[model samples]
Target: MSGLRVIPTWRHGREWLYVCGEDGGTVAWYDREADRVSLLDEARGGDALEALRPFLVGSVAVGPPPVPTPAELAGLALHPDDDLAPNRPGEHLAVALDRDPGPPRRLRADPRRRALAAQQRVGEVLDGLEAAGWRVLHAVPLPGGTYVHHLVIGPGGLYALHTVPARGRRVRVADPFVTIGRAEPQPLLRRARADASRCSYALTAEVHPALVLVTPSSAVPPAPHLFTDTTLPTLARTGGHLKPADVEALHMLARDRGTWTRA
Candidate 1:
């Protein structure tokens, strides 16, 4: 793999420098230190990769652009399911023009869309955490077609967070489960617990499972519920004795596509 290229992106909270191959849909991401790389797919893998190169190798540096607000991202024509094509100016124009080319389409209330929306909702929360020394990853697809919404690390600790759609509803956790307007908590709690366990085993750390509910008119108790406007003081309480190095390690492991995707 002599001509492999990658683009640097920041999403959910962490920086991802990855390559979406020209043909294979294979992905590989570099660690923060740039000393290591992990491939997401092995079916089209190679052991003799050359020195990695940035997608914008010769781009001229201009003044830094202003930070984008959530509104801007909302208006942008992008989504988690969109393909990350190779770096070429007009490469995507054909695909874009071939698309519906009309107003964006709204998806039905299906499991996949729910998961994607939950990931987006949690992304808004992670955006605020950057200043607080937090790092997060979103939409991590695991085995069996399941997705982990947000994996967060900060001064408080490591968390496997899931955003539950509970708009206009008051949600409460009654030990080992959550309750939202007559909805049973066991299913949600069980899934969250299993996801946390999987994340913990993957990162070799004790990951805590938490819920992020979307409610505009209710005050979430200062517990596992992480509202977009409130501080999750309890979530990243003390880093769980995790140091910066540990956090980076976990981030790299979680970012590795192979960690979640099976060969």
Candidate 2:
């Protein structure tokens, strides 16, 4: 107890403070959002409470950790290698760039780099929604070499998002086609919808498709399925489709890499 320490950590956008013993083992943890302190070593409860006194905001429930839900148990049983929960926004692209970064002196910036930037930007906004009862999975791989940019689950339902880099460019959408700046139009919406369909088939739930534009100068027509980085957080304000437990179960399933092998 002489070397007790309080260490802070973040997960799913929630803050947790762990009280550690002299041997660097967690004796207790304080969940700030839940307003609870769970003791791993009941004998050290006094030391843990003392270490966390400076960080506690108000009166909090102090006791043993709650029993794990079915989803939590499943997630805990998953092997790290087969878990997609740790993936960043542009996980595949990040790995590719790390392995073979291409010519350093190219005349133009790599398009993959632009796409990765867009994904990361959108991912930040989605990650922030975790506090609002939303769960997001990034870079979900499919049967082929393709991937869904991001999969979101919440009270608003599920969505498969595809990110488009339109920094400072006008965007036009006509059903399946999307035109950006002076570039030729592409059927990006169709691809997004297809990805959502695949996700639905894999998860046995209706997954909506959305095309997310990053920093677009302007997006015309304002379709329901079209979103910008600035407007994406609005999804968190939507509810009525699922409860907390359903969201957790879907998230646990979505984070398992094996769940997408047949999609």
Superposed on all Cα atoms, the candidates' RMSDs to the truth, in angstroms, are: 11.5, 5.3
Poorly placed runs, candidate 1 (over 4 Å): 1-6, 11-115, 182-186, 224-229, 233-237, 261-263
- Model 2 lDDT vs. the true structure? 0.88
Per TM-score, the best of the predicted structures is: 2
lDDT of 1 by residue, 160-193 (tens): 8767766576677665676776767646767778
Q: How much lDDT does each candidate structure score?
A: 0.55, 0.88
Clashes of 2: 0
For model 1 the local lDDT of residue 57 reads 37
Where does the lowest 10-residue lDDT sum fall in candidate 2?
72-81
Candidate 2 segments exceeding 4 Å error: 1-11, 15-65
Highest lDDT, which number? 2
Q: What TM-score, to 2 decimals, does candidate 2 have? A: 0.79
Whole-structure CA lDDT of model 1? 0.55
Report the C-alpha displacement of residue 220, candidate 1, in angstroms: 3.3
